[model samples]
Target: MEKKHMLQIEGLTKAYGNKIVLDNLNLTVEQGDIYGFLGPNGSGKTTTIRAVLGLVNYQKGNVILNGFDIKKDFKKSIQKVGAVVETPRFFENYSGYWNLKVMADFYDHVPRKRIDEVLEIVGMEKRAKEKVKTYSLGMKQRLGIARALIHSPELVILDEPTNGLDPQGMKEVREMIIQLSIEQNITFFVSTHLLSEVEVLCNKVCILKRGQKIEEGVVKKLLNKDYEVLDIYTPSVKKAMDCLIRDNRVISINPFSEGFKIEVQQGYADKIVKILVEDNVPVRYVIPRNQSLEDYFIEQTKGGEHIA
Candidate 1:
């Protein structure tokens, strides 16, 4: 069976006056994908989201949602989409059930039973009648998700869904997202600054930097690409460094407090060990450094913090 594309952005470019915010960015989300949209501040993550939702104007490219062109068919394109770009607003004094009831009023197809169904899906059924003010931040977040899902949207866009959450709260939201993706077959387009969350939750990721996509791939494959980083501990740090520096396979080496961090082409760790040992250098231990999503992000962004 041919896979269906839930969302597609081709050559998407956005600008504020003369400054470019999104530069020829392209991305695609397939059905049932938990796709991570990641970037430092001002990398155009928000801009791209806004463009897709038609909240902002883009200078170039096109956004297609569920085979409908957003620009040419705004209403139909957005019908299958729901989003919580930031904190969701609600009538603080109103019960959760009432809040969703009010929201369901905006659409003719959403039924009263749908509200109860969504509440159960988000694990908020027990507290569905409680006032919004009494809900914890996590509970409120779950409510926001329930609201987003009330229409049974095929794709949901969430920006920092777990922001400001405690560890338990974050875990709850994370597990909820995973469960929804598995059980409902809904596609998720999530933007988050939390690299650890993306590492565990997203099946694929797209990294943006300065309005450009610098990296995009499956999470595991990207992290396991053909590069080996090793932390070598030895008394003769200087000798080991010199020996490895001479090898053409070694990419770069930096000294740490106890040892040196070395980067080399994959499958060359054994060669590095053999070279150091043959040079009469004291061999303590060579530990394989696990490359993390954060490490990869830092490398691509060049240690740049949120820009603007």
Candidate 2:
């Protein structure tokens, strides 16, 4: 069954004076999807996010939250969405519970029980009474996520959610996101420059470059479409290299400390091995290289300067 879209962005365009930020961008977030909105420093990711939340006015486009049009029903549409952009801010002197209490007061129908529930969901229940000023950066981030959920929003949008955390903090936040998505069935649209985080946490991703979407799809499917990098170890390096070099599927080959790192088209590993064996080349081992999200991102955004 086709999952219903929780958020839809169509023909979205935003311009700043003479410069264009988002150029006719289109994206979608389906129900229960942990969608990753990815781009380089100045690929219009933040601008696109702001436009969706109605934080900035765009020259053209429509943002639909569920079935409510953001333009026509701003309050109703926005109420269903929760966002923590850049950083989550709170009164330093106030306790975590108090900070969430204050936020809950702003929205009608938000029960006190809901605040406790969200706090527990983010695993901040123990420190709920502690002052925000005394909390670590990771704790504060978890509280920020709790605040975003206080109103029971159907869709959560986060920008750089783990920007400054240490390794442990990043892991906690990542696990929390997965847990919330599973337990609460909430849809997430997160924008971040951390490719590793996106690779681990997101099932779907949209890559934007120079204010335009260059690629968008499932992470596994996208990575599987390309060749599987392999490190071929053989005593007969010269003979194996010469035999495989003639194949049209071999993309590139480079000498490694152990052997040669070869990039070959998918499904050509067996054929390459067979050729080496047929030529009486002594093959030691073949190690498949896993492609990282960073490698893919760098390849896609080549020649583009990093922008703020």
List per-prediction Cα lDDT, in the order shown: 0.88, 0.87
Q: Highest lDDT among the candidates is held by which one?
A: 1
**Cα shift from native, residue 202, model 1 (Å):** 1.0
Tens digits of per-residue lDDT, candidate 2, 186-225, equal 9999998778888999999999887898888888777765
**Superposed Cα deviation of residue 299, candidate 2 (Å):** 2.8
Off by over 4 Å in 2: 233-238, 246-261, 270-286, 303-308
Collision count of model 2: 0
Candidate no. 1 TM-score? 0.88
TM-score versus the correct structure, for each prediction: 0.88, 0.88
Model 1 agreement with the true structure over 181-281: per-residue lDDT tens digits: 99889899999877888899999999988899989888998898687989999888888898888778889999987789999999988788888878898
Off by over 4 Å in 1: 242-252, 264-285, 304-308
